[model samples]
Target: MVIFLAETAQVLAQTPQSLKPAPDAEAGAQAYADNCARCHGPTGAGDGRDSKRMHPRPRKLSEGVFKFRTTASGTPPTDEDLYETISNGLPGSRMPDFQRLPEDVRWQLVYHVKSLSAAFQDKPEPLAFGKDPGKGANLAKGKELYTQLGCNACHGPQGRGNGPSAATLVDQWGDHIDAANLTQGWSYRSGSSPRDVLVRLMTGLDGTPMPSYAEAVKPEEVWDLAYYVHSIQAEPRWSSKVAAVREELGWDKAPRTDLRLSSTFYRNGEIVPSSVRAVSVQAMYNEKEILFRLTWHDRSESRETPSDAAAVVLLEDPNSRWRSGSLRGWTGKTEPAELLSYEDGEWTALLKRPLPSGKRAGLGVMVWDGGNAEQGRHRSNSNWMELILK
Candidate 1:
């Protein structure tokens, strides 16, 4: 008896503690009415009274299409994925985190959410994601597959999300949604790891035009495509002196810093989030001159109506006050560095300023996409970034 008791204790010790409670559908239904019905609607059709006012709108739970998941896009996300989203909420959107709720309540909510869609009735198997195919060789093969797969139709030849079809695409809800700019891996709505790309390709974003490539491309080939997609990411440039010919600063040689603009700011008494979520920056300097190269994906080269443009603002005082809430510069009237910009599938700009001495200068970046109706103070901007001269 003693030996048996000891053995039972050992076995129990090895067992993993379950984070979820046995979900109660009844409890979930009540919780949904209390918490989710306002935005998701009573029927989960995404037709809540408030839905129409939101950009990208609330998801249609009945459709069982989720944007963020470790599973392939078409497949239902694992229960854990739903729970995480419910707990942490999606950034730059109206979704609010529910971490304050009890863990058991979250699991129950997941159960109720799944019940809204018949797709979750029978568990859908997740597609298999393969290993990374390294860099150079796979990138070449991936580039070939990119063309063969007709990715250029929506994502553009350079993965800038400016393909001809980009202008016409809409979500299931009839709202406009652009094909992802593959060059900015950091901005992927699902996740940005190589595995995330593979999953996106295999699963495709549900409820949107992005289709799964699981049948069209082999598993190994997906890795190649992912690697190739990663290769086109923009990088920063360094030079001992400012190049007399601007063309000399080839994009490939620049060191790159990719930034995500996920924070929403107040505009015209409403909360406005940046439609352009990511930007790449590179810098080069000589004894007297400094040049910054900035690039961001833009669906339309809006040179006429709204004119696409970018700027870099500098402040001598490191502690200069600039609030995202308002459009005031560090000082009341500091002029921005001179900016020259060009646009194709993407917007590229060169911001030149006199090199700072003594200490590093505080710099801020902003991009205006006229196609999105962004002009004047209404634009996507980043907080201050320090520029250290070496």
Candidate 2:
């Protein structure tokens, strides 16, 4: 009888998952609010107590995005992804996983993190940068002015979508977008419009890495970024084969025709190559919840991470700008080299998230050169952009 009782207790402990709530989302919420609110913010915006002093910035869960997960293409992070990040802090960032929390408790905390942005409701309010007449001519000046005004301080050099400050940046999900990749000109959560550009530049995306330019930049300079954004090609590189492989496209609505998404690079553009080029982006859904497929791989014909990246899903938001959110970035990298083959290995990232608005979104990717900045630039390999289309 004693032995049977002991065995039963062990089974109960091992089968804890059989119970509902797993780790108790409600409990996690309170614990997170008390312990993480200071830096992560009550809403998980990554602007907690010490956020201002920290380089780069804290993770903003309100954005409902995470960079270090799955593959280059955004997808739901795996248990290992969460565990590893939680167990070990990033190399050059303020983000530190809750090592003290029990395994089940950590899972509960993940649920709470996901809930931080429930109030965002990224409604399509129409972003207007409001370009004046000279706005057109100021593009070159905007490019130059971007440096003088410190826009590069946050955005990055040349605004090709990289910023030195981003190395330590973290989001609500403990991920980082690093640079905005302004050249893309498309809002991850908002539609890509001149006004959309202005709103982001002027007001800054309140909760996330983007801050209100009103405080840091002049109105005229904001116009310059708008102008430079136009002058700068935010578009990513696309090959006819890859373009035709699954018909990369984007639309005002969720698409599931013969075309499918192989992978997406939020801001693949970079002036310099690092240890590994990392990419990340948040997609906004135009319609209802939907599912898509994605992929990623090295151009050197080498598969570093996984033959298969990860899976992501989408859902229609009753209230959202794009109505969907997607994020993807590099967790680590090895060596780097120049362009090797025109046709090489291609790893896929499968989409499996809720499609909030599902209309538009921010997509990003990376190609690092072991921390070398110049290594990322490639005429044939550098710069990239694509969308889900028919």
Candidate 3:
């Protein structure tokens, strides 16, 4: 009899319905006020005081325009969908996972979030996904389908989100939207498993241009496309060590290291994205000076009045402040010792500075794309990388 009771208790613990608390939006109101209102706003309008600086801004909950969902396109998400998102949070965005909260509290927050949208009044059910034939996924067939299905028009032939129409894409709200950089699996708005890719293919994102492939492809064929896309996902590379190789000849002989750059708004503490993605850097030092050569790709040559530009930022510590003017004497005179040139959609720059009196120094890189209207603090930057000078 004791053994039978133990088995029953285990089954009860595994049951989601048995574990969930009753909905309480009243209790949820205070929780949202305390945790969510700072970014989502008091009325869930997504106009919190902190929202202005955010790229791909917070969702206006009242409109019920969700990006991730299991429901049909243009339909409200199921309650379970809302619960899961509240629990796991949206990856690659400012929204963080709230799993630390008790399951009851999370459920209440879901209830409160749903109350903000009248579209959730009917409690829409999630669309059922068809069986996945992942074991039979064909890479060649998937690649063929990728072109036939016009996926290449927006996602590019190589699935790098650099297709012909990528620059022209926008969300339903008329805000500019970037296509998913397929090579980076972690950046996918929804989860990045084969199953996650399958679901997104079956049920299209509601607010974006990605459409449901349910009618366009056979149920089994969708698995082929999902597997092909998943296969292309490559692990992104990042380096913190900048080795200043002893090269008296020039930058061609310097050791090269690659660093991924991302658009960030320091004031709001957000890592938003812009056109510039990554930069390759080479560092070389002689007896008197060090030279850094930065190379990157930019689609447009934005050299208008507000010109496209790049800078090599030097600092002694994380708290080092800019004294305005130039770096002062490090590059000699009042002007910075930097030269930049662009050609055929590529930027190459050479920065010269005197050797600092330390074993290690903080170095950062910044880029500005005038064509994208990126300027001032609204530019792409790398985190301070440790420069090892021997």
Best by lDDT: 3
**lDDT by residue (tens digit), candidate 2, 1-390:** 000101011001112345425557688888787667887888777777666534336667676554443212222333343444554444334565466777666666665765676432432222233446553556776777678767676555655444556556554344444555454433222323444455446655433565555556666667776657656544433321111112223422332211112212123231222222222222323244333433222222333432112322212222332433432322222222222222322333334344333333322233322222222222111122343312
List per-prediction Cα lDDT, in the order shown: 0.66, 0.42, 0.70
Question: Model 1, 1-390: lDDT tens per residue?
Answer: 000101011001111337567778889999888888888998899887666545668888988888765466567777766876787665445666687788789889988999999878666565556656655347778899999999999999888888889988999878777777777554445445566566668877778898888889888998988777767754423221222222355556556665544334554444555667666777777677767787777788666646666766665544554533344442221123333454547666777667666356666667776787732223676656665544
Estimate TM-scores for all models. Answer: 0.71, 0.34, 0.76
Better of 1 and 3 by lDDT: 3
Error of 1 at 259 (Å): 4.8
Instruction: By lDDT, rank the candidates, best first.
Output: 3, 1, 2
Better of 2 and 3 by lDDT: 3
Question: In each prediction, how many residue pairs overlap at the backbone (N, C-alpha, C within less than 3 A)?
Answer: 7, 100, 0
Name every residue pair that clashes in candidate 3.
Answer: none
How many clashing pairs does model 3 include?
A: 0
Better of 1 and 3 by TM-score: 3
Candidate 3 ranges with C-alpha deviation above 4 Å: 1-15, 123-125, 128-136, 244-273, 277-307, 315-359, 374-378
Ranked candidates (TM-score, high to low):
3, 1, 2
| Model 1 weakest lDDT span, ten residues long | 1-10
